[model samples]
Target: MTQPQRDCVIAGGGPAGMMLGYLLARAGLAVTVVEKHADFFRDFRGDTVHPSTITLLAELGLREKFLALPVTQLCTLDAVVEGERMTLVDFGVLRAPDNFLVLAPQWDFLDFLAQEARTLPGFDLQMDTEAIGLLRAPLDQDAGREDAQGTDSAGDVLGLRVRSAGGDQQIHARLTVAADGRTSALREAAGLRAVESGVPIDVLWFSLPKPSEPPPATLAYVSSAGMVLTIDRGDTYQSGLIIKKGAFPAMQQTGITEFRTRLVAAAPVLAGVADTLTEWEQIKLLTVQINRLLRWHRPGFIAIGDAAHAMSPMFGVGVNYAIQDAVALANAITPQLRQGVVPERTLAGVQARRERPVKVMQAIQGRGHRVIARATVGQRVLSLGAVRLLRLGSPVLRRILARVVGVGLLPEHVRTPPGGSR
Candidate 1:
């Protein structure tokens, strides 16, 4: 069977992949997004949509519709440290209108994008379709050669070797994007390696029913005993207990009673509430990681989001960064893609533009690893003097954090030619 070549074929229907497909199809280009999963109903994906993302949605005329979804907003990112309340990020300080952290389920967010993208004539989304490998043009019997402009200068990437319910087949395109995430098989097939940073903690995720009188609405509650990140999800509170890396096996050996004790100690608000969690099966482990690729592009191929940089769950900025990458990519390459084959320079430009922002965010997250490690290991993270200093400079710190976390650095807008409604 013959497969029609598209303007772009994106592997992994993640935020980066879906958004890029939408933007390109909006620009009147044929684009397809492939997802391994049958649907987008996964638990515990990053659910925080920052002010910057909300602003972009507004540019796409999606702000009102997106906010219409069942979502909660957090005006401030607060943390309770050693019984002292500190506001980490004050979204009110940001310039973006209605600046707030919108907490919506990842599935709802993805579905919303898919719904919008499907209305565009050129957008195609293939669910339950997984990319098995990369399709590369043979180097004329020579091993490898290069051109002057980008990473893989030989126009090596053809498209993707994808497998679906119907079986394996090839999808050819002028450009291929690997938005397949941190454990990206496409990234490995493209032979791009990401530099891994040492992460000292992992999160134990579980759900507890929303108490009749719920605790304060804050990002996290911390103490010498441990740290619990509280996320309000309507009827239930999706809570995460940060623990030292590789500690799950030992903690499992120790039993569920010890786990409940740590949870209660972190947030005394849930003191007697954790007693219901008697079984280990209810808890899910999320291995925390922080990594970034040295080069995000090669010839007709490029990577974005977790596929390019695996973010630590510090500020829940992973999804935000991925969305930015997609916008940047479409903005940079649309004109040339509309012309036909995209030169490697266009792909490289997207990486160059987004790399620095990702680096800065990851560095900040790296700095946080120490504090989180100490907190998870039952050490006092904030001193009396430190708390006083925070009190004195909190306003300044709060505004600064708001700008970085809420609006981010060098936020991109939609610049591609607008898509038409079906």
Candidate 2:
């Protein structure tokens, strides 16, 4: 049987894959996205687009549509320190045209991307298709390849093997992209080494009724509240409590009353909804861990998003970095297509261009986890001082913190497309 062919075959349909598909399709590449899930929309995932992502959406001509959705402008971030609450970071200081971060549902953003992506001419975004294998096209040096015959310029991508209801199928492409999440099959299949470090905190997420009065902004609890957080969900306030990994099982066994007791202990204001709690089933627990790939790419394939690096949720930087990876990948690969070739150097360049910043972010996020995990009084005092210094240290600190909350302004690699220095 003849092998199926496409310009680019992408695995996974999360934000990273969708964003890459959107841009590649817009750039006139034949792009097919294979997502395992029948329906792409799911809950209990990252929602906020960060300030930088919002800027990218505007660049993509979807900001107005994004804003039109039921969303809020998050202007502040508060944390409880030493039994006293204070602002840790404020989005209001972000120097973007839209200074506030948008609060909406992740599914809402997915709907927006799906609706917009379907309209592009070159896009074949397929749902319910599970990618199972990566196929390496016979390199020119391989025997019997003399007859396989490469195209005049556009090289055949390393191929892919997929599973569907009909049967196992094979598809080939010039570029195979792995946008799968942290537990990425593609990443493992590619033989990439990934290192994951568990943070000291375990995150438990549950929904409660909106406070009778909403809090000033997103809320965080220092070590005193078990380093938990209560964030402003669109319709309700969602709380994330950090607890010992061993403690969760006991909490689960004790049931709702015990759970609410723990919650009230973290933030007393949440007690109002504690009584109204209908189902604890809505509560989900995630083991907070950070990971990074030894390398981001190989000869015919590349991994992006959580596949490349997984960061702790301490600063909520995971989604921002994932989307940024999509942007960087698109910008780097688009030029190679125009050149009418997909050289090994080009693939290597994408990995090299992206890896440094990825390491930088991983380091920064790891440090944050260390600071938050510190239980020493002196360290706690230093942490408080650090927050204060972040606010008043200098114009640079203010700018960095502003963007960190809202998203925008960063190292050159994150700011401009690779090779765009020209």
Best-fitting candidate, scored by lDDT: 1
lDDT of 1 at 277: 91
Which residue pairs show backbone clashes in model 2? 51-406, 52-407, 157-173, 157-174
The segments of candidate 2 whose C-alpha lies over 4 angstroms from its true place after superposition are: 1-4, 138-157, 276-280, 374-398, 408-422
Q: What is the C-alpha lDDT of each candidate?
A: 0.87, 0.70
Predictions: Cα RMSD each: 2.3, 5.8
lDDT of 2 at 59: 77
171-267: candidate 1 lDDT, tens digit per residue: 9998999999989988777767788999999999988876778766777887788889988888778889999999999999999998898788888
Give stretches of model 1 more than 4 Å off.
145-155, 419-422
As a TM-score, model 2 comes out at 0.85
> For model 1, where is the 10-residue window of minimal lDDT?
146-155
Mind giving the per-residue lDDT tens digits that candidate 2 earns over 130-249? 998887655464433222222122223376888877678787777788998988998777767787775665777877777787666656766444455777776677667767555677
